[model samples]
Target: MFLNHGSFGACPAPVFEAYQRFQRELERQPVEFLALERRLPELLDAARERLAAYVGASPANLAFTTNASSALNAVARSLDLGPGDEVLLGDAEYGGMQILWAYVAERTGATLVHRPFAELAPGPRTRVVFCSHVEWTSGRVNDVAALCRLAREAGALSIVDGAHAPGQIDLDLEALGADVYTGNCHKWLCNLRPSAFLYARPEVQDMIEPLVISWDFHAPSFPERHRWQGTINPCAYLTTPAAIDFQAKHDWPTVRRRCHDLLAAAELGLEPLTDDYVQMRGFRLEHPDPPELKRRLYEEHRIEVPVFESAQGWVLRVSVQGYNDEADLEALRVALAAEL
Candidate 1:
């Protein structure tokens, strides 16, 4: 009953085993895997093909990264923004993404503006709005098509963080219409640890630079420039196709809907805290005696639902994934009932 797939995704057993096999193959012949291998690029291309098909994008425009944070950094660090340029973001964005932009603004003197929901009506002055497809901390799904319209009207580029959306929502990246989108395969796709992708429209990809300028920096190919960042574990990226297959094998959409139902039922008081949502139920845990309630639920009951205090009130985030079942939800509810 891992409720916190948002923190670090839980890889399915098959996917984990596949990753181990990749590592084993690498260890079997490091020289072949890294240097002498003739088939590595072809293999990568196949993985990219599968990913592009899943997300509705061209394989050439997508680049694999460790996570959404790193993907956002690559985009943030590359854009040539100076003192006058502005990057509008929402207050509800993940903390890591905000920090990435903060670093860029601090060094380059570009203004990092928070696009207030109050003023979010179709406007014409906002520059490059960075938003999440789904609010991570709060399960509020956004109308991305509408937001894209607003950004286009403002002559702004849109960067969408879709960490919580891949497995939870039905997405067509080409139709989503954001200038750039980043999502985690490890989280929703149930891949091995830290596998994620950044998708940029073909025109946008050239402007975006790789985070780590390795030997591929000067290469002629798009994948070379961004893909070969460092000599870290590439198993996660390599085995993503298997993860996709795993989802397909299980009829992922039905499983996702079932999880959502279970989570909604378990959520006692938590309510939506943000406007863009995909997975997780952000309930208003405004019930009296919140602290003692959560403590007893966790300590005495061994329930593992996430409860935190927010501006709205005490909020409990309930999540259901393939690895979780009704028993897990019932246990959490039982524990909460005891405390509440």
Candidate 2:
């Protein structure tokens, strides 16, 4: 019945219980559970190890973050941007990131350049090349490896926003070769909310400065520096391993393939924007008013989807997750016919 996995992800019942279990343990013994000298570091390190193996990175170079936006802020804010320096970004970057980068550029006197996501070309003044592995707007997967290579060849840092990638697609961060990468474990991976990671290559780890100068400020490594951010719940981070296990036990690859096929069928007459999408597809909406269509679809017919204006016009994106099926698509179809 739920098709908006991209907007908000849900944890499987087992994973949710695991998250709750961790929370209860923390609540019962705050100091013993959260104190660094005790179980907190061990739990986080184990979680990081599992996640690092899942995403293809070293635990030492990986840091847990609240969300992708916060992770990117840590990187973007730490950079010593100055006048004439450029932060090249994809035109279809997420709206939240657009605001974050705009603030960073405004505060640092750096130029933020927008280029096509698929065919980004870095210039001489480019200091950083930022892009999304899977675009949030169109649900199209960009060639992140190629983009990272291009940024490296340009002598610039490559930063990827992978908020939508983690469990949606298989990842090998080392293979992708980006200077910095951030992804959400809650989405697709189905952990809990606000759980994500930031990856920096060992050589470039020192360049990263924690957004908050906390207890770990004098810690020896990048992960240690960003590991403890003051009394924050570690339940979501600790439950990520269980989320990874849930996918493996359920054979998510097969489920994803099935979802992709269902989405393809749903996109048949929807004027699909591109074939690059897997589980999620964006359709070109000819509706006179996109806002009205969106409201009517959800409020009247109970079809929850994103229909909004973008650079390419009004778009309606349909997501096919393991929980979605042909009936959901059929319901959406019936609703669209009635409304349009």
Best by lDDT: 2
Off by over 4 Å in 1: 116-125, 272-278, 287-297, 309-314
Let me know the TM-score candidate 1 reaches against the reference structure. 0.90
Off by over 4 Å in 2: none
Give the least accurate 10-residue stretch of model 2, judged by summed lDDT: 265-274
- The lDDT of model 2 is 0.89
Per-residue lDDT of model 2, residues 1-340, tens digit only: 5778998967899999998899899989899999999999999999999999999998887999999988998999899989999999998888889899999999999999998886688889999999999888788999999989999999999999999999989999999999999999988898899799999998788888898888998899899999878778888999999999999999999999999999877733578877898787788889788899899888998888888777667888888888888999999988887877
Q: Against the hidden reference, what TM-scores do the models get?
A: 0.90, 0.97
Clashes of each: 11, 0
**In model 1, what lDDT does residue 114 have?**
77
Where does candidate 2 clash, by residue pair?
none
Q: Write the per-residue lDDT of candidate 1 for residues 1-340, one digit (tens) a residue.
A: 4576665667888888988998899899876676514556666777888888888887887888888888899898887777777888776677778788899899888888876433554344455788877776676777776787778777888889998877778778888888899999888788887789999887777888899998778876566677777787788988889998898899988888787777665645334565344457676776677777767776788766677764445677766788888898777766666666
lDDT of each: 0.77, 0.89
